[model samples]
Target: MSEYRVLVVEDSPTMRQLIVFALKRIRNLQIEEAGDGVGGLKKLSAHKFDLVVTDINMPIMDGLKLVSLIRNDPQYKDVPVVVITTEGAIEDRDRALALGANEYITKPIQTARILEVAKKMLGV
Candidate 1:
């Protein structure tokens, strides 16, 4: 069986580490990390990922624009993007959904919930 690839885009090194740690706990999980949306886009374009977890606020580019780009690209249109961000506002959630995020979760994340969502989405 192939490992499930996950792209994690966040600005904070600590948060990124936390996410990486949580995801590593799952078996057959392969992770790639990016510091911002630009890096995320670069990675996305370079490789195929089964799932993406991105932050809303980032330098150079934001998660919304990155996700919109992903949705707009015919090649990557069907890829599932999960927004894990600090922006808990209703409008932000609506915007993310509109931009093609399959799911949204607030920051200070619960690792178990993250795992559950990942498992449900990835069917692993």
Candidate 2:
């Protein structure tokens, strides 16, 4: 049985793979991947997840927009979102958090950091 479901939204295949690998270490997780925020939205609409991990910059849509949509939409409201991105600026972190991301980690990402945040966000 799955203990949790996590959606990883990243445009880069390599980055997405890395995030998936980290999430898999948590055990009992059903992980889903999306190429961008638009795809993330589609996945969210189709299924329920305990967490969302996204990258800040991407084509079609971005993490900020995803967070806003998730936070404002009643269907997705209260879901935890973690933004892992190369955009390490203070403003970028502030923006993502203000938009309702539960956690923000700038690249290059540490394996333990991602896993730690994921566990904390999921209450595991």
Best by TM-score: 2
Query: What's the lDDT for candidate 2?
Result: 0.91
lDDT score for residue 8 of model 1:
94
Cα error, candidate 1, residue 66 (Å): 0.8
Candidates in order have lDDT scores of: 0.86, 0.91
lDDT of 1: 0.86
Residue-level lDDT of model 2, residues 1-124, one tens digit each, is: 9989999999999988888888889989999999999999999999999999999888999888999999999999989999976754778778999999989888888878999999999989
Q: After aligning candidate 1 to the native by TM-score, how far in Å is the CA of 86 from where it should be? A: 2.4
Off by over 4 Å in 1: none
Error of 1 at 91 (Å): 1.3
Each prediction's number of clashing residue pairs: 0, 0
Clashes of 1: 0
